[model samples]
Target: PPNGAFRGFGAPQTIFAVERHMDRLAEAIGMEPIELRKKNLLGVGSTMPTGQVLTGSVGVEECVRWALEDSDYEAKRRTLGLANKPVGGRKVRGIGASVFLHGAGFTGSGEDRLKGAVELDLLKDGHVRVRSSSTDIGQGTETVFRQIAAEGAGVPFENVSFAIPSTAHVPDSGPTVASRTVMIVGSIVGHAAKELGERVCKEQEAGGGSFAEASNRLIEREGPVVAHRRYGHPAGVKFDDATYTGTAYPAYAWACDVAEVEVDLDTFEVDLLGFWSAVDVGRAIHPVLCRGQLDGGALQSIGWALCEEVQWKDGRIVNPRMTTYIVPTALDAPPFHTHLVEEAYEHGPGGAKGIGELPMDGGAPALAAAIEHATGIVFDRIPMTPERL
Candidate 1:
C-alpha cells in the first residue's frame, strides 16, 4: 500500500467502523441507537479491549453528558418520532452520536522514556525565550507553550518568545503525535521556566534584593539567562505490545459528541444539522484554542461518518482529487457547541493534560446513533452513503 504520513493516523477509520456497528446494534435490539451507546459508555475503571485500565483522569462520562444536554438529544429523539413523516415529499431526518478516547503523550511507557528538554532564556530586558523541539503543526502548540512558560516564569505573555525547532538549537522532544505535544513538551517547558524563576529568586534573596533586581542581576552576570529541564516517565512502568493487554496510556482524554442530522429519504442523503461535543482537557490554558480543537475534531468526525471516503481502485486511491474525495463543506457542517471540562491530573504541568486527539474520538459514534434514532434504519458502513442507506 502506498501510504503517506497523516495526522489522525488510524482514529478516523476506527471511529467509522464503531459508529456503523452501533447503528446495526440499534436495529437488532429495536431500541434507539443513542440509548444503546449510553448504556455501554466507558468510564474511569472501564477496561478497553486492549485491557488497559482507564485509571487516570477519565472523563468519557462527562463528555457524554455535555453532548446529550447541549444537543437536547432526548427531546429531539422524542420529536423525531413525530417528524418521521416524509418532508418536502422527499426528505427524511435522523440523528446519531459517538464517543471516543485518545491517549495523551506516548501510549504506555513511551512517556516514561521520553527525554525532552526545554530551555528558558532570560534576556537583559526582563523578557523570556522558550526553546523546544516540538513542532507547531497549525495546532497552536507554540502559542500554548508560550502561555505555559509565561505562567511558570511569572512573566507577561508578551515578554516570551519561542525559538524555532532545529537540531542545532533544541533538544529532541519526540515527535508531535498521539497528542503528546501539550502533555509532554509543555511540561518540560513549564519545568524549565519554573526552575529559571527559582534560580533568579534565590539570587535576589542571597543579594538582599527583590525578584526584579535578581532577574536584572542574573542577566548582567550570565549575559543571557538560561535554564534547562528534562522530562521523563517514572521507573518500573511497562507494557507488553504482543498481548495488547498492558497499560495502554499513561493518561486518557475523553470526549462525547452529539450529532443531529436530517436525512432525505428519497435521496438517502444525510445532512448534518448540528453538532455538540464536550472534552476533558485537564486544564484549558487557552479556552479559545481548546474549544477550537473540539469544534474542529467534531467536524472531522462528522465527515468520516456522513461524507469523507477514500475511494479505492485496484489497491490505489481512485478518488484523489478534492472534487471526487468529498469532505464536509460549509453547507455540510452544522453549528457546533463545545464545552471544556477540566479535571486536573497530578503529574501534568500545572495540572494540565492533553486535548489534541480527544475531540475526534467521540463524534462518529454519536452521529451514527443519532441517525438511527431519526430514520429507524441502521447504517452499518463508513461514509453512510446514499446507496448503502
Candidate 2:
C-alpha cells in the first residue's frame, strides 16, 4: 500500500518540523515561543508560498489566543514547574501550543477541472431526491447534505432524501478526498435543489402555494421535475496549474492546539494531562460533528506522536497484530477541550470550509513541543517512546 490514507495526509510531518523549529528559534532569541509564533502568523492579505493571497477568513491569530486562554497557557508555564519539585522522585509538567492551517478542498484548479456535480429530482409526493456520488463515511455527510438540499428546495428536511451512492444511479461528484464533500459537493447539491425549485415554480399552476404543494403539482403534470448543477470557481479566482502558482485552495481552515503533558524523569514516560484546541472552521455546519472531528483527529495524531509505531524485521511484518501493535485507547486519552471560530467563507456552502483534516495538522507538533518543554530534549522524531525519551 502507498504511504497515504491517514488523517492529515501529508501535513502532520511538515507541521511537526515547522512548529518544533519555532521553539528552537524562540530559545535562540530569548523570546517567548508564543510571541514568536504570533509575530510570524499569517493574516488577511498575506501571500502563501504558492502565491495565493488570503483575501478573508484568516483566523489563525484568534485561534492561538483562544487556545492559550482556554488552556491557561501562560499561567501554567509559570507554575507547573513547582508541581515537579518533589525531592528525589521528579516529574516535570509542561504545556505547548501550535497554530497552523489546512487548505480546504482540492488544490489549485483541481475542482474546476473535476466539475463536481449534483442532481435533484422533485417527486409527485412533494419530496426531493438528491442524486450525487458523495459517500458518507461517518462524517455526517448525509445529514449535512440533506440540510443543504432542504434549505435550497424550500422544503422540510424530512422531505429530502439521498440516494445511496452508486454509479448507475448518481452523478459523479468526484472522489470524497481533499475534505471537499460538504464544501464542494454540498454546494452543488444546494444549487441543484434551488434550480429544481425554480423550475417547479415556473411549471406549477399560477396560484401561489407552499413549495411542497407547487412541487407536487409540477411533478404530477410533468412526471418528475429534475435539475442538475456543477461546481464552478468563484469569479476572479485564477490559477495556472502548469506553473503551480495560483489559489492553492478555495479556502483554508485554521487551528491552534495546546498540549499539557507530564514527563517522569526516572521512568521516561510521558502522560498527556490535557489537550486544548481552537479551530476556525469558516462556519460549523454542525457543532457536534465539528467537535467530534477535532477530538477524534487530535487523538489519532496524539497516538502517532506518542505511541503508534510499526516494527519491521527483514522488511517484513512484525507486531502486526492488534495485541502487539500499540495504539491509544480511551484510558490513554486526555481530556479534550475544543473551541470553534466562525469566519465565513463567501464561496463556501453556508460559509463552511473543510474541517475533517484540520485537527490532524496541529496535535503531533504541539505534543512534541510539550515534551521538549518538560524534559529539555529536542525530539525531532515521533512516537517518542520511553526508550527514545
Candidate 3:
C-alpha cells in the first residue's frame, strides 16, 4: 500500500510489528509479556536515542499499570488457558497489550527550523478569526484550533470563527502532519492570542473604556488590531540537524493498548472483542474530541492489522474505490474505551498536548500480541487474512 499520513502516521504500523515481537519474546522466555515490558520500560528521566532526557510528564509506566488493572488482564489471561476445553469448541481467546511513546511534533528541531507562524485578527463584527494554514482533514483540526484560540484570547468560544485554510489569509503554521497541529501550531496560535489579548487590555487601560469600546477604538485608530507570532523554541530547546541529535520532540505522547481477540478456528476469522487505550496527551482540550481521535485510530489500526489489503493491477491500486476496498465500519469496530491521563505539557495551549496519532501507535501491536496468544502462531506480517492463516 502507498504510504500516507493516517491517524497515527507511521506509528500504528510500526508498533504492530514491535508488539508482536514483544509477545513472541515473552513466550520464548516463559514470562508474562507485561512483566518483561515493565522491566525494560523507560519513564521520566530516561534518555532517548538522540540522548535527550525525558524530563517532564512521562507517563508510560502509569499507562501500563492502569491498563492492566482496568482490563483485568491477569484473570483474563488465565481464562484464555481454558480455550482447550470443549465448551468453547473451534474458538480461542487471547488478550494482548502494547505500549509506545510518540513524539508530539516534528522529529527534531523541526519547530525551531520551520518557524511556523499564526495571526489573530479582531474582526469588525465584534468577533475573532484565527489565520493559520492548518487544514482540517476530518481530524478535528479546525475545532481544536478554535478552542485553543478562544480560551487563550479569553473570548467566548462562540465569538471565534474558523477561517478557510489559505496562504493568502493565513500564515504558515507548517503542515498538518506529524501530530504537530495541536501542540506546535496550536501553541503558536495560543501565544498569538495571548499577545493580542494583552494588547487589547493595555489599550482598554490607557483609553479608560470597556473592552469592546477599546478594541473598536484601537482598530479604528490602528487600522486593525492584529496579533502575529512566529514560532520560537521554549527556553533551552535546541537540536542538531547535522547530527540527528538533541530533542526529537518538544513533548512526547505515551499510550498503552490492551486488546482481546477471539479467533474462529474453522474460518481463521479474527474478531476483536474489546480494546482499551490509555494515553497521556498532556491534557485534552475537548475530551470528547480526544476520544474521537482515539477510537478512530484504533479502528483503523485494527483494519491495518487484520483485514486491509491492496492488490495491484499493473501500476494502479486494484481497490481504488471503497466499493472494492475493505475498510472497517461501525459494525466491525470493537468496543473501545479511551482513558486520558493528563500530565499537561507546560508548553502546550491550555496545557493540552497533541494526540492526533498517539492512539495509533499501540493498537496494532496489542492486536497482534492478542492474535498470537489465541492461535499460538507468531506471524511476522500483517493483513493476517484468512488465506494467510
Candidate 4:
C-alpha cells in the first residue's frame, strides 16, 4: 500500500485510538482523564510492549511532568467537565494529553550494518570540506553539521563547506530519516575532522613547524589532506517487524503534550483553546528550530484529531481536495507553550538525541482526551468530526 511519509508514521494512529480510550477509561472510573494519562505514562527504564528496555537516553517522563504542570491541566479539566453547561452552544471546552517516543537512527541494527560514513578534506587555507551522503531535507542539518565540524576541528563554522550526497564523491551514509543525521552522521563527520586536525598537528610537531604550516605542506604535497571514517552502533541489537517486538530502537526520544479544546455539543464543532508541549530532546542543537518543530507537529496532530479526515465511502476517499479535506488554519491553532528539557546522552555526539518525531506523537491523544472531558462523550476514531460526535 502506498502511504504518505509521515514523521510519526503509524504511531499517531495508535495515539489517537489510545487518547479516545483514555477518555472512556476516565468516564468509567469517574476520574480525570489527564490523571489517567499521568498515571500510566511511560518513563525512563520503562519497557515498551516490544520488551525493549529503555537503557539509553530517556526523557518522556520529564516532558509529561512539565507539560501537565505548565498547562494547569487539572484546573482546566474541572472547569470543562461541569454538568450544568449549556448544550446548544457553538463551542464547548475540552482538554486532553498524550505521550510518545521516537527511536533514534534506523531501527535496531540497521545503522550498525550500514556503517554510515563521513569525510573531511582539510584544505591548505585552513578551511575544510565535509563530505557525506546525508541530505539536508530542510531540517537545519547542514548548520548543525557545520557547528559540529567547527567545534571538533577547532576551526570557524564558516571555514567548512559540506558536499551534498553524491555516490561519486561521498561514502554511503544511511538514508536521512529517523532523526539520525545529526547524531549519527554528524558524529562521524566531527570525528573525522578532529582526526584530520590531530594528524596535521602531529605532522607539524614532527617537522618543527606550526599546524598551519604543516597543513599547507600536506596540501602542497598531496593536493588535499583528508580524513574519512565509518560509524555504527554496538553489536547484537535486533528488531522483529512481524510482531512489532524486539529492540525496536536502540534509543528513544520522548515528549508530552497537553491540549485545550472548545467543542459545540449540538454540532460537535471543535476549536482549539490552547496547547502546550514539553520535550526532552537529549540536546537541542538549534533551540529555535526545535520549538518550531514542536509547534508544527502539534498543529498537524490537531488537524488529524479534530478537522482533517480522509473521508471514505465504500473504501474510497470521498473528500480528497483541500476544500473538503480540512487542516488547521491560523485561526484554528491555539496558543502554544513549549519547554525543552535537555537530558544529555553519553553515546550521542555532543550529547545530542532525536527530537523530530516527538512533537507529532502526542498531539492527537491530548486533544481527544480534552474533548472527551468537556463533552462527556468518548471518541475512538481519529478526525473526530461533528457527525461522529
Candidate 5:
C-alpha cells in the first residue's frame, strides 16, 4: 500500500518508541522514570542531530514538570505502584507519561522553496481583506488570520476580513498542511497588513485627515491599494535537504501527556480513567481554540492508541466502514485536562507556534506505558486487543 501523509505525519509512531524506551531504561537503572525523563530533557542550548541548535523557546522541561504537577502524577504513581502489582481480584491501576516535540511549519527547505505569501487588500471603506490560498478546513484559519491582520493593520478586528481562499483571487500560499496555517502563513499575513497600515498612516500625515479618511482617499486615488509579503527563513537558519540535516523546522512545539488507566483482568479491557496534557505552543492566539485543538487531537490519539484500527484480509481491507472499524465516541473518551505553556517564539504571529498536531504525538505512547505499568506485560504492538493481551 502506498503511504500518504496523516496527522502528526510519523511523529506519533517515533514518539511511542522513544517514550517506551525511556521506561525500560528507567527500570533497568532502578531510577524513577519521570526523574530519568527530566534529567535528559533538552533545553534552549541543546543541539539537534540535524545540526540545529535550539536557541530559544525550548520548553520540554516545563511541559513535563507542569504535566506531572497538574496531574498529581507522583501521587498517582505511588498509588498505582512504580512496578506492576495486583490491586485487587480483577483490576489494576497504572499511570504513565510521555514527553515529546512537534516542529511547526514545513521541514528542511520546504518553506524556503515554497515561500508562502499573503496579500492584504485595502478595501475602500477603510477595511482590510486577507488574500491567500490557505483554506480554513474548520481549524479556525480564517478567524486567526483575521485577528492577525487586524492587529498588523492597526484596525479593529471586525474591520479585517478573509477571502474564501481561491487561487485565482489570492497568491499561492502553499497547501493548508503541516500545521502551518497560523504560524507560517499567519506571519506573512501580519507583514502584509503592517505594510498596508504604514501606507495608510503615511497618507494620513500628508493629507491631514483621520486614519479612515486617509485610507479611503488612498484607495480612491490609487485605485487598489495592496501590500504583499512572502515567507522567509529566519536569518542564518539553513538546511541541507539532500543530506536531511540542519534546522529542520523554524520552531518546535513541546508537549507532555500523562494517562491513567485501569485494566480489567477478567475481560482484558483497558479503560482510561483520566488524561492530562501540557503543551508549550509558544503563544496561543486564541486560548479557547487552542484548548479545543488539544482536546480534539488528544482524543484522536487516544482512539489510535486503543480501538481504532483497520483490518486486512488477503490483499484487501476487511473492515472499511465505521461500524466494523471501531472508534471512540464522546462517551468513550476519558476526562481530559489540557494546559498551555506560552514561551513566545520571536518570529511567530503573536509569538504563536503550531498547536494543531502536537496533541496527536503523545497519547499512544503514554497509554501504552500506563498499560505496561498495570500488567507488567510489555506489549509491542498497538490496539492491545484482548486476544493479544
Candidate 6:
C-alpha cells in the first residue's frame, strides 16, 4: 500500500502536481502552455537554486524541439480544441505536453562523498567480469551492465560475465538508486575496461599473441589482471550540504512528454490514446533498452494520472488488493512513440547519462495540460476519475 519505490522516484507525483499549476498559470495569463514552457525552460547557462551552474551538453532545448515537431503539438492542440465542441459520442479529445529535467546522480556533494568504484577481472578464457554493488531489480540492469562491460572491454557480448552484487567480493559502487547505475557505475566500468583493454592490447603486441593468450599470460605473471577505478566528479564540482546549496547533480536528463487523451463527456472517464516522449539521455548505451525504459516509465505515469489512486484513511490503506488498486495493463496502455536526443555529458563514459526515471518525470504534467482543453477544468489533483470529475 505504501510506495517504496517506483519509476521516476518521486517525480511522477511531483511533476503531475507542478504541471497542473503551470496549466492554471498559462490559462489565467492567456498564454499558450507550450509557449510558456519554452520561455521558461532552463538552458545552457541556467543556475540552480543551490547556485550551481549547468555546464556542457545540456539538452533540454533539444528535447523540447524534437518533441514539439514530432508530436505536431501545436497543430494537434488547435485541431483538438476545435473538436472539443459537442461530439456525437459525447467524447472529446485533447493533447497534453510536459517537459522535465531529472538529475542523473546524487544531489550535489553526494557523489564526492560517495567515492564509487568498480573492479573488473579479465579471465584466461577471454571473458570480462564486472564487479560492483549495482544489482538488477528487474529493470534490465543485468542486460545493460553486460552491454557496457563488453563494449568497454572490447570483447564479444557472449564473453562477458555479470557478477552478482556482493559486498564481500565487490566494491561498493554506491546504491543502485538515484538513476546512477548507468551514468555512475557504467562509467566506472568503462574506465576500468579502457585501462584493462589498453594493457591487454599492449601485452598482445609485446607477445605477438591473441587477446585471450595475452590475457592468460598477464594473469599468470601479474597474478590476476584486474582494473579498478574510483569515482571522480568533474573538475570544480562542489556542494554545501549545510546550506543545501551546490550542484544538484553532476548531469541532467532532459525529456519531453506528449500525451493524447479522449474524455467521455457523459461518463467523465478518460481514455489514453497515445503517448510520445523525446529525451536526451546523454547517449543511449543500448537504444532499444532505453526505449523500453521510456515506454514503461510513461505508461506508469499515465496510470498514476488516470486511475491508480490509493484510498487511505488516517494513513491506513483501505484498498490494497489488485482488484481495488488500479495499474496499467497492456490493454490499458496507449500507443507509444519514443525519441532520443544525444547531448553528451562530458564526464560520462561513451557519452551516457542515467535515464532510468526520466520518462516518468514528465508524463503526468503533459497529460494534465491536454485535459484542460477537453474538460475546461484545471486538474489540481491526479487520477482524474469520473467520481472526481
Scored by lDDT, the top model is 5
Off by over 4 Å in 1: 19-31, 46-52, 81-83, 86-89, 208-212, 234-237, 314-316
Instruction: In model 1, state the lDDT of residue 339.
Output: 84
Tens digit of lDDT per residue, candidate 5, span 1-389?
53577788888888888888888899999998889988989998898989899999888888998899999999888878435455446888888899899999988899999998889999976799999999987778888899999999999999998998877899999988897889999998988999999999999889978778999999889999999899998897899988988899989999999999998888989889999999998998988888888988999898888888888879888888889988788898899998899999999998999878889999988988888888887865687776677
lDDT of 1 by residue, 1-389 (tens): 55763446677667667766766777698987667778898767888776766665777678788878888877777767326564554665555567776777776667656676777788755578888888987788889999999888888889889888887987777877778788777887888888887777788678967666788888788776788888776443457766766776667677777777777767877777788777888888888887877777677767776778787888888988889878876666688888887877666776678777766666766666666666766555667777877
Model 1 backbone overlap count: 17
For model 3 the local lDDT of residue 154 reads: 76
Worst lDDT window (10 residues) for model 1?
A: 81-90
Which residue runs does candidate 5 get wrong by more than 4 Å? 1-3, 81-88
Q: Among these predicted structures, which one has the highest TM-score?
A: 5
lDDT, candidate 1, residue 60?
Answer: 68
Return whichever of 1 and 4 wins on lDDT: 4
- Report the alpha-carbon TM-score of model 5 versus the true structure: 0.96
lDDT of 3 at 160: 84
Q: Residue by residue across 17-100, what tens digits does model 3's lDDT show?
A: 777777778889999998999999987788998989988888888888888888888888877833553575888888888889
lDDT of 3 at 330: 97
Query: What are the Cα lDDT values of the candidates?
Result: 0.74, 0.86, 0.82, 0.77, 0.88, 0.83
Error of 6 at 2 (Å): 3.5
Model 3: lDDT to the true structure: 0.82
Q: How many steric clashes does model 6 contain? A: 1
TM-scores, one per candidate: 0.89, 0.95, 0.94, 0.88, 0.96, 0.94
TM-score of 4: 0.88
